[model samples]
Target chain A: MSAITLFGILDVLGTFVFGLSGAMVAIRRQLDIFGILVLAAATGVAGGIVRDLLLGDTPPAVFSTLRPLSAVCAAAVCAFFFGALIDRLKRPVMLFDAIGLGVFAVAGCEKALAHGLAAPGAILLGVITAIGGGMLRDMMATEVPRVLREEVYALAALAGAAIYVIALRLGLTETIAASAGVLLAVALRIASVRFGWQLPRAPGS
Target chain B: MSAITLFGILDVLGTFVFGLSGAMVAIRRQLDIFGILVLAAATGVAGGIVRDLLLGDTPPAVFSTLRPLSAVCAAAVCAFFFGALIDRLKRPVMLFDAIGLGVFAVAGCEKALAHGLAAPGAILLGVITAIGGGMLRDMMATEVPRVLREEVYALAALAGAAIYVIALRLGLTETIAASAGVLLAVALRIASVRFGWQLPRAPGS
Candidate 1:
């Protein structure tokens, strides 16, 4: 598949996972339908919006197209129809969130590289875009972001971005680089969660 | 004074007020000093950051100068010193907020116009820049924005933007037009608050 098509698939998958996580949070908060939709929209598109804005693109994806709109619609539908099933999942919501983080990290890095950003800038954008939507969602929920509090979230994205850049330098094809990056991120995140790996805080105690 | 200088003064004044409001909210939430500073910085400069991004300006204000940093510092000092006093005088907070809204509305419109935006786009930017900081604050606080719910807030900014555009079209000087716009916005906002004026809800409310 073309790089563009691969990017599109990853983007939509990331949006759906992010939207579902946001909806789950909204459900836990007992927000109304409007609130749920708002949270879903914000979570699904906030990272891309920030990425676009920082890249000097205008109007943001949330305002520019129907993809984000459809993502929100799908989130709302899932929340309304499969609410019970979703709530009963054995693994915590963090599994889906990890998938989102992996996909978005790869997608964001790819987009930044396509836009001619240097490797460092692309990596920073990758990490930011992977976690930005969840950060916004947590801010809106008045909760600390998971990346800030729990999980090796941002670190995973950073590692994946680094791998992607290195692969590009080694003359790897786009699909191979992207697959490697996404899998690396997902594996690192899931392994971190399973093994309780976390960043060390300042030693105060 | 030159028109640009006058607008610059207004911009600083608005930043001060926005920072004050953010610090107050942080104090109310019982956040630590670091949290207070974070909120202050976010509230004082996020609107301008978003505006600059939308206008395709590189290295947004947050990265460009120390003025925004100074504004946050000033706010932190004020909040630390006068937290109790501010907590008691809620009316003064509202009045200061009105003034800030007026200044931001005029400044936003003028900036958008300078960027060669059309009247509608300028007006929209005016409203967004005037209230966007507060929206971010409310989102961080996990509350619906007061501008979205309370008396004639965004509407007042819109009115001021429209008046500014009209004055410009009528060949008025920039200073006169901006001053008139600010006054119009402040008066309308204060009047709305005093008389309990509000917009009609969307249909089906």
Candidate 2:
């Protein structure tokens, strides 16, 4: 498959997972349908929107394209219909969220590289792009951002970005590099969650 | 006084009002001190940050200087001590917020014109810069953006931007043009609030 095609698929998958996670959180918070839809749409597209804006793109992808809107609608519909079932399957939700994080990290790194950013900046952008939506979601929910407080979130994105850059240096195929980077992120995130790994809090609180 | 000096004074005043408004909102929401401080800082500097970024200026004003930070601290202190007194005053809070909006709108238009943007784009950006902080604040609070629903909020900014552009076309003095623009915005906003003016809602539910 072409690299662009693969990236597009991964991007849509990431949006789906993000939307689902946001809807789940809204449901847990007992928000109404408007809140659910708002959170879902914001979480599904905010990271990419921020990334694009930083890259000097206009109007933002969420506003300019149908893909993101469709993804949010699909996720919201599924959540509306199977809300109870999804809530009961906590492990599955976490799994999907991890997968979304990984896909977003890889996609962000690629976009940054395409925009001609330096390696370190591209990696940082990748990490930001992967976690930005969740951060916004948490802030809107009046909670500490998951990436700031939870298990290896931004760290996983950073690691994946680094892996993608290293793979490029080794002249690996795009698909192989992308898949490897995403898998590395997912593995690290899942391990951190399962094993209760955490960064130390900043001192002087 | 030089035009730049006038603008500088307006910037300081706008920063103060922005910080005060943010601190007040935070207090009303019953956030802790840290939360209040964060919101104050975010609201005080966020508009300038957005303006700088959109203008393609590097190292946004918040990071480049101490003025914005100091303004935030000062506002936080005021809110911490005099919040009750300020809240007791019926119209002071709204009046101060209107001043901030007016100053920000003028500043945004001036900055956009300086950056060589066309008049229409400058006006649009002026409105964006004026309301960007409030949008961010509302989003963080999980509320519908006031600009999207409130009475003539963004429209006031748009009017100020348009007036500024027209004054420039007529070769008015910089200070006179800017002051007139700000006054127009403030007047429109206050009137809108007093009279309960609102745009027509979209047709149908």
Off by over 4 Å in 1: A80-82, A90-95, A194-205, B1-45, B57-131, B136-205
- Tens digits of per-residue lDDT for model 2 on B1-205? 8977877877777888778878888998999888888888888888888778767776777897898799888988899899999888749778878888988998988888887777766775687689888877776666655664567887788899899889989999888899889999999999999999765431221
Candidate 1 local Cα displacement, residue B123, angstroms: 12
Clashing pairs in 2: none
TM-score of chain B of 1: 0.93
Name the docking class for model 2. Answer: incorrect
Listed models, DockQ each:
0.14, 0.07
Q: Give the best candidate by lDDT.
A: 2
CAPRI class assigned to model 1: incorrect
Models, CA RMSD each: 6.9, 7.7
What TM-score do all the candidates reach, one by one? 0.61, 0.59
lDDT of 1 by residue, B33-91 (tens): 88888888788888887777767765776787887778777987799789998878888
User: Number of clashing residue pairs in every model?
Assistant: 0, 0
Fraction of native contacts under 8 Å reproduced by each candidate: 0.18, 0.03
